[model samples]
Every structure is written in C-alpha cells, then in structure tokens.
Target: MPMRGLTILVATGDAERLHTALGFAAATAATGARIRLHLHEGAVALLAAPLSAPNDPARHKAGLPKLGELWEEALGLGVAISLCQSGLALHDLDLEKLDPRLEAQGPVSVMTGLGDDRLVAF
Candidate 1:
C-alpha cells in the first residue's frame, strides 16, 4: 500500500517521445505509483482532439499507439494531464475553448503542489 506519486512534465514531444512517455507512465502504474502529466509547447497537440497522430509504418505494423490514442489511454488510466499557462498562451490556445482536460493545466504553482518525489521533464 505504499504507492508513490509521479509527475511527468512534457515540454515537447514528437512521434517518438510521445510513444515512450505513454508507455513509461502506464508501466509505472503497475509498480503502484500515481502519475501527473504536464503538457506544454508543441506537445499540446497530442490532446487536441480525436486523440490521434499520424501512423508510423514500423509502429503501425506492430500495432503501436498513435498520438491521440496514446493520450486517451493515459487519461483512462487517471494520469493528471496538466497544461502550462505560458506555453499555451504563447501558442494562442484559447483556455475557454479547450477540452475539459486542459483545465488541469495550470501555472507553475500546480507543479509545486505535487507532494511526490517523482518528477520527469521531457
């Protein structure tokens, strides 16, 4: 019952990093740890709706997840997907029009609020 908490800060991700982070976080839950995912920069597109990215031929042949699929999966697992204020604002993403999940994205203050020791910035 000693489950731990983990906060994953994703500043940016393309095809590769997205796949890895999703898998890594899902696997961590098996070790009895919680997860929080912070999104910023270009990474915000992963959850921009329809929850999918372009197919990687190699990964597709192996039935790996696409961008959107990976995000939906992580959400289903209860990882807190937070957005960065400055990052989104810089990108001109309207906070009011964003998905409900985007609201979880907050200022640096929220990051400081995590009590867990696990913090990964990618």
Candidate 2:
C-alpha cells in the first residue's frame, strides 16, 4: 500500500543530513503526498535567517541544488515545515529571525500531529 503521508524529523545540526531530508520531502510531496518536516534540536539552525550550508558549494558545483534551494522547493511543493520552540531557545535563536515559512511548534505537537504518517528521522 502507498504511504498515507510522510513526517520527517531532523534533529542533527549536520547540513548534509538536512539537505537529504529536504530532498526526500520535496520528492514525496511531488507525488501529492502530505509532507510535514519538523526541525528539532540543533537542526533548527538550518532555518535561521542567514541560512548557511558549508557543503552546499560542492553540491552547487556538481549541478545540484543548494540547501536553501532545496528547502524552498520543499515548501513550494506544499511541505509544511516546523521548528521546535524549545530547540530555538536552546540555540538562543530568536524565532522572529528565522525563516518566516517555518511554523514554531513544540515537539509534542509535532509528534502528535502525525496521523498515520510514515515517520523518518535524520
């Protein structure tokens, strides 16, 4: 049977992992599946205003999309992205300064919101 939906939880600060997660989200969303991505722990930094990806240069040189570009594509494909509020506080990041596209939510809400969706962690 096909997946009902997809929920991706990103808890690492690694840029490459974040890139991969967003890529999956974009691809799944393209198939008209409901996609929700939750950024928790150190991964919240990926949505910070000055989005930085140390490895994006190499990916760009290889004719691949940058991290930020992938993120935008995921959002454009109707993926719902959320950033954990506690994670933002842990990083001392102001929610207002992060990407406005992100919905600030608690971990519990992110988890409980998943209804029969396949959960994937990165």
Candidate 3:
C-alpha cells in the first residue's frame, strides 16, 4: 500500500469538533503517516496557549482524550501545525498572542504546500 499523507483543515471552534480533529491527527501520526493540521475560521481560537478541553463526561466515556493532551501528542509525533492569518484577523485575534508552536500562514500557502496529501476538513 502507498503511504498516505493526511492534512486536516479545521474550520470550526466547537469543542467537540476540535477534540475529534485532534484525535484524527494523533491517530494518523501514530500509524506513521505524515500529518498536517491547519486551523482556519473559528478553529483558529484553538491556537491560543493553554487550550481548553471539553468538560462533558460523555466525551470522555466515548474514549476521546483531552483536546490539549491530544494536541501535544500530535505535535510530539511531528505533525505540522499552522493557523490562518486571515482567520485571526476575522476573529480579531492577535497573531503574536497565538501559540508559538503554530506557524501563521495564508490559506493559499497552506493549500499549495499540501501537494498530493489527502485533505480532511472539520
């Protein structure tokens, strides 16, 4: 089988979606796949330091780990993390205040850099 590359484009700020998307990135990376996580739209809020995890017990019972933990795992696994600059401006967020681990770039730069990777948007 061909090695598959995964690119996750996150566009929502919903805690549940962020949790799920982080899960995907960590899981994919665990399988030795190349992974890239791009935060856009409202999802850019997650790039802030000290991210919040979902508080619902059901999410935990369903086997989803804390979003912050999953994010750390993903980054440790070498998943490239990026945030949209326009998204930050749209939401009135300062780029300097975002997590230093995330690279700030335009959407076109991210998309063009993906090459042949499979893209999954959340």
Clash totals, every prediction: 3, 0, 0
TM-score of 2: 0.89
Q: In model 3, how large is the Cα lDDT of residue 85?
A: 87
| Cα lDDT of model 3 by residue, 1-122, tens digit | 76689999888887677778888888888888889988887888666546666574655688756677677788888888888888788777887765577788888998898888999998
Native RMSD of candidate 2 (Å): 1.7
For model 2, residues 1-122, the per-residue Cα lDDT tens digits are: 66689999998888888889999999999988899999987898655555557888898899999988898888888899988888888888887866577788897898789989999999
- What TM-score, computed on C-alpha atoms, does each candidate reach? 0.77, 0.89, 0.82
Misplaced by over 4 Å in model 1 are: 30-32, 45-55, 104-107
Worst 10 residues of 1 by lDDT: 45-54
Model 1 alpha-carbon miss at residue 58, Å: 2.0
Q: For candidate 3, which ten residues in a row score worst on lDDT? A: 47-56
Stretches off by above 4 angstroms in model 2 are none
Q: For model 1, how does the per-residue alpha-carbon lDDT over 1-122 read when each residue is reduced to its tens digit?
A: 77778777776746567667777777776566777777776776554545544565666689986666666777777766777776676666676787575554564666676886477777
